[model samples]
Target: MTHSTRSSHPRRRTTPRHPVSPRGLRTLRATWERQAAEAGGPGGFHHLHGPHTHGWLLADAVPELLEPIVHADDDPLEPTFFAHLDAPVAEALLARFAPAHLVHRSNGSPTLGNQLRATVAHPGEITLHGFVLGPGRCDERLVSEGALVRFEADLLVTEHHAPGCECELLWAYAVDELGLDDAEHAPHRIHRIHRAEAPDETWWRLLWA
Candidate 1:
């Protein structure tokens, strides 16, 4: 048998190019990782939405802005980047992803709620299901199991049953504690406010807020 000659140079590992966040996506990733590790099980990534989905969407839609949340070994249903979401966190995320005047798509009606107004009116009560890029359809994909959201009075989100967390609490906090309507940067102050006044620290610490 003839011996084959090998090259001296080592092959370089190829990593796919992704989006980037100005604040450094690694901070978000680190926060989730720490939260998960501290929780001692799967962390906050246990739910359908929450921090895992937040990271996933950022990575998927704008990978160049932040690192990807899901890995090759990640579970399709339960991902691996968990964190408790409170009023400030939810509001910040909503501001980042679901802006104020985004076109609403439910039942194909032009008359619907705008994201900002509804969120402002009712904090923490809105939890978006399905991908944000596609048309809102009446199918299993857009409307997942128990992820129903109902609106009242045109601007307030009355009821919300999301997959992983209780968003209504956050909304209540926004209305009661944060006074989101008056403060333009209320979302930015959620963490501090939550740390100070949340009634159930155990629940907030144990699972997604």
Candidate 2:
């Protein structure tokens, strides 16, 4: 019964503009594994990466925290809500919902003032994808409260460009609302996968691969 307060905006096309071939998908997954291994596993890679990040949370918390702005008009699991959030509130929410294996990215030096902030691209689109992960495999899952959520946004990057560049940003989190009895259900982890200000070349390659 929760209602979303944010006004509607254009939804991004579900299909990728440049779809990856089956081989490309394999290569992309391999590269991700290699990068993760080299960087001391996924936790290390996330830390070494730039400011963009993602994380996991219990699906139930989504309604509790964002009830005012997460309407049930659509698939409750795919409810659209505001991405921008207050810094303290964002931090507290993450802390409360984070799983034991959730490794937070380093915010870099305080003197440089490069801390991660909760901001979103306005005049753009937001999209979500769902997946399920087991010990050594991952498979797409229908968008649901119990599935892992991949949150992505396409927005303009104006920081260093007179004419802003359009780019994609991504992050992910997991939820377990189904009480699935499987021991290998996806882990509850959240990670910031990419940022517009500093895009990861590898991620771009994978997208276009």
Across residues 1-209, which tens digit of lDDT does each residue of candidate 1 receive? 01121122222233344434556335434543443344334342243442222222332222222233222112223322322222333333333342222333433211112333343454444322222211111110111111112222122212243354344455455446433233222121111113334333311111111
Q: Which residue pairs of candidate 2 clash? A: 4-69, 5-69, 53-192, 54-190, 54-191, 54-192, 55-190, 55-191, 56-189, 56-190
lDDT of 1 at 86: 26
Q: Can you write out model 2's per-residue Cα lDDT over 43-137, one digit (the tens) per residue? A: 44232334322222222233234332232222212223333233333333333332222222112111101111121111112222222221121
For candidate 1, the per-residue lDDT at 176 reads: 61
Reference-based TM-score of each model: 0.22, 0.22
TM value for model 1: 0.22
> How many backbone clashes can be found in candidate 1?
12
lDDT of each: 0.29, 0.25
Q: Tell me how far the alpha carbon of residue 105 in candidate 2 is from the true structure, in angstroms, after superposition.
A: 13
Compute the lDDT of residue 68 as modeled in candidate 1. Answer: 33
Q: How close is candidate 2 to the true structure, as a TM-score?
A: 0.22
